[model samples]
Each structure stands twice: as C-alpha cells, then as structure tokens.
Target chain A: MQKLLDYGPLLLGGAVTTICLAVLSLLLATLLGGWGARAKLLRPRGDPLNKGLIRLQARVATAYTTLARGIPDLVLMLILYFGGQRALNWVTELAGLDTLEFSKFLAGTLAIGLLYGAYLTETFRGAWLAVAKGQGEAAEALGLRGLRAFRLVLFPQFVRHALPGYGNVWQVLVKSTAVVSVIGLEDLVGLANDVGKSQRDPFLFMLVVIVVYLGITSVSGWGFNRLERYYSRGMR
Target chain B: MRFDLVFEHWDLFARGVVTTLELVALSLAVGFCIALPCGLALARGHRSARLIRAYVYVFRGTPLLVQTYLFYYGLGVTLGQYDWVRDSLFWPFLRDAWWIALLVFSLNSGAYATEIIRGAVITIPRGELEAARALGLSDRQVDFLVLIPSALRRALPQYGNEVVFMLHGSVVAGVITIQDIFGVTQTFRARYYVAYEGFLTAAALYMAITFVIVLIFRQLEKRYLAHLGLSR
Candidate 1:
C-alpha cells in the first residue's frame, strides 16, 4: 500500500502520457480517414473532367485500407518502429548526417493511426452513405456547391451519423495505445509493470492498472454517449 | 533485401507458423465453447446475465496485452510462490508459457464472441421464435434446434471477423516469449541485423492467412446464407 502510494505520481504521469498518445493518434487517424473516405466516395459522374484522376484516387484509397486492415497492429508497429529506424538512419548516413533515432511515441502513434485509419475510413464512408443521397442533392438544388455545401449542409448530418462509430473507434484506439508499451513507451501499463516488478507484487499492481483502465474506458464511454445524444437531438 | 537470410532461417519461420496456428485454433475453439452458453444466457436475459455482462465488460475494456501480462507475470508468478500451487499437478501446465497464452487468449476471445453471439441472437426475427414455440417445441428445444442454428448462421460473418481479430491478437503471445510468427520475425531481425526482410515476410504471411480466412468465411456464408441471397 505504501509502495503504491509512493508510485502514485509516476502512475498518474504515465496515465497522462497514455491519454496524450491516444488523442494524438486519434487526430492523425481522423485526418487520414477523412481523406480516404473522400477519395473512396469520389465519383466521375458529377465531374467528367477529372475522371481518370478520380479513378486513381479511389484505387489508391482502396489499397491503403485493404493493406492496413489486413495486417496486425503490433506487426505494423514493429515494422514501422525498427524498420523505419533503419531506413531513417540509412538515409541520414547517405547524406553524411548523423544517424537519427526514431521516437517510440511517434512510431506507436503513426502505426496505430495508420491501422485504425482504415477502419475509420469505412466508418466515415458508411456515415456519409447513411446520410440520404437526397440530402446532398438537396444541398446542390439550393445552389450550394463544393466546400460550402459540405460544410453547411452535409457536414452536420455527417457528424450526427458518424458520432456512434467514431466513439466506438475511439474506445478501441484508447485500448490499443497500451500496445505501445511493448516498444518501451513509459505508458501506464509499462510503468505499472516496472513498479510492480520492483515491489514483487505484480498482481496487486495489475489490479490497480486494470481499475485505472476501466475508469478511463467508462469515463470516455459516458462522454461519447453524451456527444451522441447532443448530435442526435431533434431526430428519432 | 535480405531474402537469403529469411531463406536460411526457414525452419524458424515454419516453427512460428505452427505455433501461431495452434494458438489461434485452440483459443478460438475454446472461446467459442465458452461464449455460446454465455451468449445464450445474455440474449435470453437469464439469471446469470449480469455476471456475464460484467465479465464481457472487463475483458472488452482492457487491452489483451494487459490481460496477458496480468495472467502470466501477475497471477502466474503470485501463484508460483504458493507451496500448494507449486506442488499441484496443474503447476506444470501453469508454468508453461504456451498454456498461459492459450488461457488468456481464449478468455479475451470469449468475451468478444459472447457479444457477437448475443447481438446475433437478439436480431433473430421474433416471428422465427414464435414459429418454433408454435411447433410444440419447448424453450430448450427452440433454443438448441432453432435459435442457436440460425444465430450461428447469422453470426458467421461477424465471427469470421473475430477469428481474424483473434489471429491478430495472438501476436501478443510473441511478446510473452511464445515463439509465435511475430516472435520469429523479431528473432530473425535480431539474429541477422536485417531490417525489412523478416518483418515484411511475416506481414505477407499474416496477410495470406487473413486472405484464407476471408475466403473460407465467404464460402461458408454462400452456402449457409444462400436463403438470404438476393438472387432468391
């Protein structure tokens, strides 16, 4: 009990790092996912001038999502972390520069972001599709075009539709951040393991770790629920 | 680039493949067995529903890696300190990393399977249940003969996803010194000091396995779900 309390600040710091990693990765995933979704949904019907480019875009997006989703997250992380480090060092040495070290935090975030980005692309595409085709047509009928139409008309509806799936993805992504500890990130799980090993009471320390994870998940679940309710207002 | 190194260490890769397959197969089989009854209970709102829900919530909420570490390093170590546990017949199995991997993976997979099954069971049309009841089938008979069969069919696609997910999740076994596929890749990388070849090869292998899983599930769906096909 005294040892746990002594390590309280360290565990709290680890929890903060975990949250930061998750949020940063979520931002990266949402960015990639949005672009992937747009690329996938690009249609030549509306604009014949760029038909060739759109087809290429859609194909590239399809390949990205397929490859990312098929591989396991841990494998991808290892490949990106170690393989990426080697590549970076090779490039730097070739340029007569000092060999660079790849940060575990960055590698973890990027690997997870890229992996979940595939799933999020599907989620976002589904959400966009769920918004009635009539809605987009209606926006165009009202003489709203391009970015304005999407921002003012389609975006809100997209949010309302995407919130549930987004929340689900967020929850899973948060849990996945724990995998970063394998790469020696000083995240909650990593810290707990270290602390527990030194104290020779890993079971008790692990129970505390589990409770902390449960708390994080439960709190976030509640937040997502509230967000969903807010977005879903004025509709059945 | 280091294809020669990978070829030289082919035996390691083969061993890894066998371990990975065994881990996934055993875990999924055991997980499904555990989940089926729990799922049915949850779907039927049985008296044990709350307990099952709590189990699902805990497993789903935590990372599988954390669960793995907790079981192996935490519980396994703690139990080893006990004279009774050390002297028990089960200690041999408990001390083996493979068994611990199997136990943790199965429990994690079971939690996800339970939810998949419960959702599938609930979405079963009310009329189907009514018809089964109308046919002089008792509740147990209806569940086993009608509900379970249809639910399993409906759950096929989702369960296929779970199987792939389990395969992916089983990579954590590598972290625990299980010499699974990913572990083999790590060993190859460390041994040869080569970067891309080993990990990329493992990636290709995993992708191939996933492709096979998807193909098998597609065939299963085509056969069992033919009635729900649009052509009909």
Candidate 2:
C-alpha cells in the first residue's frame, strides 16, 4: 500500500507523457487522414481524360490504408524506428555532418500517427459518405463555399457520424501508447514496469496500471458521448 | 540485404511460427469457450450488464503487453503462496512459458469475442425469436436451436479479424521469454543488425498467416451468409 503511494508521482508523470504523445499523434493522424480521405474522395469519377492527378493521389492513399490493415501496428512501428534511424544516419554521413540522434518521442509519434492516419482515413471516408447529399446541395445553393459550407452544413453532421468510430479509435490509440514503451519511451507502461520490478510486487502495480488505462478510456468515452449528443441536438 | 541471415536461421523462425500458431489456436479455442456462454447471457439471460461491461472494459481498455506481464510475473507471485497448487498436476503446466501467455491471450480474445457474439446475437431477427417461441420452444432452446447458430455465422467475419489480431498480439509473447516468431525476429535482428530485413521477415510471416485466415473466412462467409448478398 505504501509502495503504491511512493510510485504515484512517477506514474502520474509517465501518464502525462503518454497523454501528450497520444494527443500529438491524434492531431497528426486526423490531419493526415483528412487529407488522405480528400484525395481519395476527390477523384475525377466517370471522366477518363481528367483523371490523371487525382487518380494517382487516390491510388497512393488507397494503398496506404490497405497495407496498414494487412500489417500489424507493431511491425510498422519497429520498421520506422529501426530502419528510419539507419536511413537518417546514412543521409547525415553522406552530408559529412554530425550524426543525428533519433528521439524516441518523435519516432513513436510518427509511427502511431501514420498508422492511425490509415485507420482514420477509413473512418472519415465512411463519415463523409454518411453525410446526406442534399445538405451539400443545400449549402451550395445558399452560396456557402469552401470552409464555411463544411463548417455550417457538413461538419456537425459528419462529426456526429464519426463520433462512435472516433471514440473506438481513441480507445485503441490510448492502449497503443503502451507499446511505445518497447522503443524505450518513458510512458505509463514503462514506469509501471520499472516500479513493479523494483518493488517485487507486479500484481498490485499491474492492477493499478489497468485501472489507470480504464480511467482514461472511460473518461474519454464519456466525453465523446457528450460530444455526440451535442452534435445530434434537434435530430431524431 | 542479408537474405542469408533469415535463411540461415530458418529453423529458429520455423519454431517461432509453430509457437505462434500454437498460441493463436489455443487462445482462440479457450476464448471461444468463455465467450460463448457469456455472450449468451449478454444476449438473452438476465445477466448484469455492468459486470460483463466491466470485464470487457478492463481487458479491452489495457494493452495486451501489460496484461501479459500481469499474468507472467504478477499472478505468479500470488500463485506462489499456494503449496497445494504446486503439489498438483497443474503445477508443471502453470510453470510452462506458454501457460501464462495462453491464459492472458485467451482472456483478451474472450473479451473481444464476447462483444462480437453479443452484437451478433442482439441483432438476430426478432421474427426468428417469435417463431421459436410460437413453436413452444424454451428460452434456452431458442438460444441453442436458433440464436447461437446464426450468431456464430454472423460472428465469423469479425472473429476472423480477431484471429488476425490475436496473431499480432501474440508477438508480445517474446516479452515473457516465449521465443515466438517475433522473438526470433528480435534475436535475428540483434545478431545481424539488419533492422529492416529482420522486422520485414516477421511482417511477411504474419501477413501470410493473416492472408490465409482471411481467405478461409471469406469462404465461410460465402457458405453461411449467402442470403445477405453483401460480399466484403
């Protein structure tokens, strides 16, 4: 019991790192996903002559998301961390420059962000499809264009549609932070492991760790549910 | 670049694949056992949703790596306190490396599978339920005769995803010193210092299994879900 108290601060600190990592990855993933989905969605459908550029972009996005589903997340992370470092070193050496040290944080963030981008591409694509077509026509008729139409007409409805899947992906992303510890990131799992090892009481420590994760996911779940409700206001 | 590194260590990789297969098969089998009854309860019986929800939340909320460690080291400490357990026939099995991995993987898959099963059962046709009851079938008989069979078929596609997921999740067995395929890949990487090739070998091996499982599930879906006319 006393040992739990002793380890609390360190675990909390680690939790902070995990949260920050997840948030950064989440932002990168959402942005990339948005772009990827747009590229896939904006293709010159039913037009053979005008299809060159968008077709290539759509092909690349499709390939990325498809391969991601085929491969495990861990494999992708390992490849990026290990292979990327070597590639970076080779480039630096060719430039006659000092070797660049790869930060675990950056590696982890990029790996997870890239992986989730594939996942969220699918999610955003589905949500985009779910938005009623009439709404877009209505927005255009009202002279709403670019970001304003998206914000006023499409965004709220698509956000509502995306909420359930986003909540799912968020939970998955939170759990995935635990794996970043494998690459030597000082996250919550890493801290829990060190404390558990030193105290010689892994059971209690693991139970606490489980509780920590459960708390994060549950609280986030509640928050997403609230957001969903807010977006769904006045709709049946 | 060193294809020979993987080739020279083919035996190690083979053993890793075997161990990985063993883990995947055993865990899915065991998890199916747990998921079946629990899913039925979640679907039909007056079970406490809170209890079932808590179990799924805890397992699904946390990473499999932490869960593995909790079983491998944490549960071992608690089990060490029991002399009778040590004296029993189950002791040697408990001491085996595969035991804890098996246990944790089963529980992990069980939680996910239970959700799949529950979802399938919940979405079973109300007309079917009425037909079963109107034919004077008991609630238990309705589940056994009509509900579960259809749910199993419906659950197949999601369960295929779970199988691939469990295959990937079992890579953490290396953390517990089980020397599974991922473990062998790590060992190969350490020895050769071939970062990309080492992880790629593991990835290819995993993808092959995933590909095969997906094919089998596709066939199963064709046979079972032909009525739906939605081919994924």
Candidate 2 interface RMSD after superposing interface residues: 1.5
Judged by DockQ cut-offs, the docking class of candidate 1 is medium
- Count clashing pairs, candidate 2: 0
Instruction: State the TM-score of the second chain for every model.
Output: 0.96, 0.91
Residue B20 lDDT in candidate 1: 99
How do the residues B1-232 of candidate 2 rate in per-residue lDDT, one tens digit apiece?
8888888889999999999999899999999998988787787654566687778878888889889888887656668668987887877877776898999999999999989999999988899889999999998898789888989988888898889889878888877778898888888888888887878888888888888888999999989888767556
Error of 1 at B151 (Å): 1.0
Residue A28 accuracy (lDDT) in model 1: 95
Every model's DockQ, to 2 decimals?
0.71, 0.68
Candidate 2 lDDT, tens digit per residue, A1-236? 99989889998999999999999999888998898899889948666756877788899999887666666667778888877889899999999999898778888888888878888998899999999999988999999998999899999999988888888888888887888887778888888887788888888888888888888988998999898889899697
Taking the tens digit of each residue's C-alpha lDDT, what string does model 1 give over B84-125? 998999999889999999999999999999999999999999
Task: List runs of model 1 lying over 4 Å from the truth.
Answer: A45-49, A90-98, A141-145, B230-232
Q: What does the interface RMSD come to for each candidate?
A: 1.3, 1.5
TM-score of each: 0.95, 0.94
Q: Which one wins on lDDT?
A: 1
